[model samples]
Target: MIKPYFLTALSGLFLTQACIADVNLESVTLDNNPRVLKSIALLQSLKSPQTAMQFNAPYVHDLKNRYKVRSLFVESQNLPIVDIQLTFNAGSARDEEVATGLHGIANMAAQLMDEGTEKYTANEIARAFERVGAQLSVKAYRDMFIVKLRVLSHPKKLEPALGMLMEILNHATFKKSSINLILSNTQVGQKQIQENPSRMMNVQFYRALYGKHPYAEPISGTQRSISKITPLQLKQFSNQFLVAQNMNIAITGQLSAKEALKLSERIAGNLKQGEKAQALPEPIDKSSFDIRHIASDSSQAHVMMGHLGTSRFDSDRLALEIANQMFGGSGFNSILMQELRVKRGYTYGAYSTFSFSQVPGTFSFSYSTRQDQLLSSVQVAHQALIDFVTQPIDLNQLAETKAGMLRAFPNNYSSNANINAQLGAMGFYHQAADYLSQYPKLLEKINAQDVQNAIQKHLHPERLTLIVVNDQLDKTALETRLKQDLNPQAAQPLPTENLPNILNPPEKEVIDLPVSFPTDAPEAI
Candidate 1:
């Protein structure tokens, strides 16, 4: 659930049409005069890593009253820095389940919250942050929203930026003039995205996997849902959910614990009590398997296949993490890619990922290829899953995946923004406070059998939701093929045209053509 940041994090950033599947390091080319490695070596290696925890800042449980305020405070006399985060529970999923996607409208409203509070206009808010050399932001997530400030540890540098943030949160005037400009452009852009087959596949996949779960709903409202959302609705939603009960405050860098406590208190003190959130009920017991395909006129089929996956709370989450990497996630070296692309040439790249959410999220395998490859590709992917679960994962494979996972984990925390995201995830998912600190250790402890067990529990390919986006693929033939390969009976196909009746309003019917494959087709990874 980590989102990409320009500076800190990159998560599952699979394809770039502009970039090809070559190991060539174009960004670090030999043609340019590069830093002479020999010269740097002669300069001598770090006697010790220049960046290390000389002073391991012990996390304070701070055991403050839950209602009054809760915040993490850290001050390093060594560096004059401060990072503060305020996270609340009014994330995008708070939108009405049936109407869907009001969360996006809420996010846009939050961005424009400071358009013109009585004291400052939108431009003034920007100018103030520019003057202070600080970053101020409000971001929306699936389960929460965040307001943050990062600045040098000086009152002069902090107050104005924080002041603007307060106005944005507490008293926002969603100016009528700005409303049309923001909403109209947003709606148009979303419309374009929904039309794309791959995007549509992903959206519909969530609806299928979660099956009426709140988390299954789209973050951005549907076309009709957004049209009905007014600024008044934004105000009302914020009022109901952005209260102190759901708020968590954290500070890092050079801020005193006392100062951190005082600041956290001040920030949360005036917010009125937010409405209580309902705990989601247990997910429905999965029944006979279902194939939820979305046939489209696109040249290639966009497939989204998966079943309910482990939660962050699952004991075997770390094991599942390792298995995911070995099975489909290790990029070129993975078994899925090795069999499907390197050996057989099914798709350019084939991969799988296990999403760890507050509740069980989707464990999905996604790949796009010529429409005809649809059935065979799913069978191949499913066979790979079966082999992974039954076989004892080689210890070397587990070790390699663990090492890779640990190495990649720190890259995610390298940016302040990225760290805050991890913090938000940890807080919201009920993950222990030490989740990040302990990530390496936990991943290291995962033995091979742990992975096999996780697979057995979660990878019931029998109940998997196999979706393919091209109508030309012979569904009947594929189902017969899958039923033969795997003992699980393949799900019967539903008439694709019927989906829009309950999901999206019906659109113009489009015909799909039979897809042709090259004798030597370049894999679509």
Candidate 2:
């Protein structure tokens, strides 16, 4: 009853429908089969072979002016970016003992670099860089002040940026208005820091640890000191510390050795050839263990405990670093974290660190817990440290710790900025140029016995100073706990007023008075 063409079309439609039904059934079977899905996941879980990191040392050049420049030329033909950092061995540590406020002056001077120059206004200077997508930043650390610039490598962008930077370095005006603004901001910041319990704890801890050492002084000068700083003092500080002899230049990214050399010369040539800063004196260790309690109206108590630690030049630094990682520096796997957070639920986190400086630095273990648990938490953390140093770590723990450090080492140089920072540190600390390349090897050479020896020799948990900042601490309970868990003789109560008042000045009221002018008729008559 149907025509031939219609029959052909009907047959083709039926075949197509059958093929689609088969496909749908196949898909359903694949999705429903657990073994097949597991097999697919297993197939996708392949990983590439792990490779060891190889560090390339930078080309070191000495400029005619006695400035040392370290250049690392990363070849990136596809990209056009360059990073330059000029580090001067002029930080808070160099602030004269007689002129303690010079620390704030140095920091403020670094900040004022881009505020304005003889040739460019502040706004204009900012626009010059913003238009070309460049960035300029200044940082003042405990040991150094750094001026950094990042810009495109093209001549148009690079030349102008360099010129602007030179202008800032050689001809910065440090206007009175800018100085006043910086001083006001610094005062406000210090006041805010005073209100922060954790910061106050650190300030107190450092004061206890360093004693009369300059390290005890806050990096940002105290309110009283900052208020006394003048624009002339800032200029004098710049002249003394920011000199050719005291500077190191680090250049990275898309630049040749010759170009970097020329740039470094240009940057350092205009700088004054002043003498290097005087060296810092060694920090003296406290005679006995001490505990200081600061009263605060906070629900959580902040505790910091430890003492003076080794310097960058310590022979056992690598071993101590690994030992610290196992004891508390590592996250959840660390002994302190496990004891305080997981096993006892005493705190949310606990950590220990060794801060290595040019001179001797500090080792600190810190934690925060509910006010009620303050003493108990301190006892637990203190015991953990004592046990870590007294007991020798087994081979497995040592292996795991070393492995973790090695795994994280490559991340130290993961970015241009990080690499530059490391380089700057090496220069500032006078570390060998090959220090980065040799670090992993040194870490590998450390053994279980080495770690144990370093801990036993350097870490003195019995001498740690415990500082607690809490409003709710029960003095009777704290005294009882100390007698039970620690030496009763070491426990001492400190008045909150005795705490460092670097930020806040004694409260004073403003009094308004009528002023008499020379031209006032009544006063003249």
Candidate 3:
């Protein structure tokens, strides 16, 4: 006998073929067409079996390096290309070490690294890479600075690309002209952030949550901070953080383990053996609800609520990952989406996410709605979080989430590039070498009770920090409404003294300092 799912699939395929054969969909009017509408309805009704997919684990090789540079390699002979990434602990978080107020020094240094080295002009550098069909890119995040190179596996192509990368790392000159260009672009971005509601809310949110910590500042830095960055500071930052001891290497594609080790050593030998960056201080957790209201002219309200969450090293990290997926991380199946978008039609989308980084990261839920519906949406989202934290997990949904994750797990390392990325992250975070192989078994062992316990231990609904960008009311009125709606059963009303004074933000104060310029400045445009 033909099974139900097979019959449904066969029917769907024949119907699809008939529609394609009979109709010119572009020419047909869709408004009142009976046959087309009937076909669409029939297609929507078709279902497929949710069977688990098995995938073989990719073999990962750990290459030994004597230069203190950790290395992970995976050999893929199918492609005639190589990908290399060097991840350093020199992100914006280390800016303060360069100077007290140099928030963007790391970002500035990264931008200037490849512009001009001691041996080549910026244009020469560009043409050299182009001649070899190679690509070099640099990016700085809150936790790490990454330099990536991609080139064909042929010796001629790989040799020149590797040489250019080393020259940039060891002898790049951070000229004054490049500094001025980045500063000008950052100033424009700061102005644009002020005018954008979502960006403004993000800036204020971090400030409120991490008062005096290093993470309080944005990676881009503020106008006041960026203006103070100098060429000397950029050089100091680069020298201190970009070192063999402070970074790791990830190599993938068309390379034997022996060759990969030699390549890793050559790359590591070019840099100074500088000390590792000191560990970052953890951001303090809030005790009470801290709310801020940014008055905007937008008819829709942008809201974000969260607090400091767990770190990458936490034992319950995997459980919290699953819990977050069930709560708001998944699109339509998430609890927040079902309550806010599907049931009430309050917003088009609602999402919750967790960031597990070097220190405790943030767990946040964000959504936007009409100004008049702001309070209702906030209440619904908050209540959903409360119930999720305080109640038992739904066992059926937990099973479904685990199954979906298992099926999708193979996609994480499906290609050489993707596998290299995973290896890089694993080495940086000090995970066991068998982490990838063990992830599925560990995840399967996480029961519903474990998920519920993890949620209860990590998530704090009562101590959330809230930020809203809306034009509906003044700060005082909005504060009152939030207190009433969120804590209706409190014998005494929720306190507003802890709220930030958002109405009168201080103006940027500037101080002038003498600056020096390189004698061989690039010619002005």
Candidate 4:
């Protein structure tokens, strides 16, 4: 008799075959549908697309206290739900070099804030939010730690949620048991990173790109670092960094400005006054080409390349944003995507982004492809970047990119949550009060020449550091390909042992190469 599993597999095969054979191609054809044709005709007859988007930027009411607590309120009377985003200047950037993993203390402290408070156990805190249909989220990033909450604006739901939030902020116990559990889970996560080639590549890429910089450190502490974190350290970090003056709050929802201000004051009144975090030492601008290839058993290669990018303060940021969109930011319309994926079919996706921050950030172009196609894919991507700066972008392409950005700008304030987040970012980043209002005007004034100028000032193709992670079996071929495709003087191989310690040493081996443009090549951008 046939096995049960075999019968199930046979039934699945039969169902799939039946689906394939059931289609009536003629009946489903667009030409055979009169209603579809009529709909298409009606849609085509509509007036031309709007050339200008009308956006009424939200009014932000700013308030502060003698204790230096800052808050921004955006009134959204239509929605019943309220969103509050509280941000602290404390981020991984403040992690001490000696205690390299102290940032994990901040992260762990945030995660455990709701686990238990002075007045409530973890179960009680969770149930309190659940009963009120409220949501709470805590996140730690390179630049800041955030605690966000959403709940119905009705007093019955809002009051308890606010009380619980205040309790968590003031009385997080940071129990030893919770700390140990989070640390163990984090270690498990680190071990799992070993199995992810893309994440492993990023760890090495950031290390090579931002040498000796705090940004070089993984946001998640290493195995040794995580193990080193203790309860006392976490409490100290929270006491020092999670104070009133270092925090900014943004609230948006059905509440009146008066009610929002009252809530903000309640939250801020309970905290101790503290000073803003000290500025990080500026990262050295070293553009020497570097490439790291982590040996993986996977059949495909992951590639990332670029160099230090501009800060958010740069005047040319808007222009660079548009230029990037025209080059590799737009989906299929981007030049890199069209060249590498659409034309050559080397990979399913190719994209580029400029991760601008309060400090200088990175601009990277990344793609993944079969190991054998790695060199060709890189060559194509490299050429695309060079061309993007050297050649003038078409006027129509510039128009389309600008239009797309402007059209999507309103979505940034589409909901209470979105508006709260955007307002929070503006405050955290020290953006001008009128930043959102002036954004459309800025986009409107930019032209193709402005974009090219921005490209020239911001992007440096020749100084890019290329990183490729691929199967060890292709190592020899990749080395040969690099020599032929890039300058020999600029290409220096690194020892496999020098890669970031977070990743497991390959079963085979690794290849590291430093690449630079030819000496006779055109100027930086």
Q: What are the candidates' C-alpha RMSDs? A: 12.9, 13.6, 11.9, 10.1
Show where candidate 1 strays beyond 4 Å.
1-68, 73-79, 97-105, 488-525
- lDDT against true structure, model 1: 0.63
Q: 406-490 in candidate 3: lDDT tens per residue?
A: 7778877888777877877777787766677888899999998899889989998878899888885455654555455556485
The candidate that wins on TM-score is: 3
Question: What total of clashing residue pairs does each candidate reach?
Answer: 7, 0, 0, 0
Put the candidates in TM-score order, highest first.
3, 4, 2, 1
| Cα lDDT tens digits for candidate 2, 1-525 | 899999999999999899656653224444567555445444333433354445553443333333544333333333588888788877767665327545566677778889998788999999999988899998666677888898999989998898888888777888999978987787778878768776787778888887778777666667777677777777777778888778777676676667766777777776676777787889889755777889887656788888888887789888888888888878888898887766766666678877777788888888776655566677677767767877779678789988877777777666666666666666666676567677778889998888889999888866777778877556556545545444535644311222121133222311111111101011000
The Cα error of candidate 3 at residue 207, in Å, is 1.5
Clash pairs for candidate 2: none
Q: For candidate 3, what is the TM-score? A: 0.83
Residues forming the 10-long window of minimal summed lDDT in candidate 3: 516-525
Which regions of candidate 2 are displaced past 4 Å?
A: 1-78, 101-103, 472-525
Scanning candidate 1 in windows of ten residues, the lowest lDDT window is: 516-525
Model 3 C-alpha lDDT versus the unseen true structure: 0.79
Off by over 4 Å in 4: 1-53, 64-66, 101-103, 473-525
Q: Estimate each model's TM-score.
A: 0.78, 0.80, 0.83, 0.81
| Candidate 3 off by > 4 Å | 1-52, 472-525
Q: Which of 3 and 4 is the better model by TM-score?
A: 3
Model 4, range 49-78, lDDT digits (tens) per residue?
A: 553436887888886544556788888889
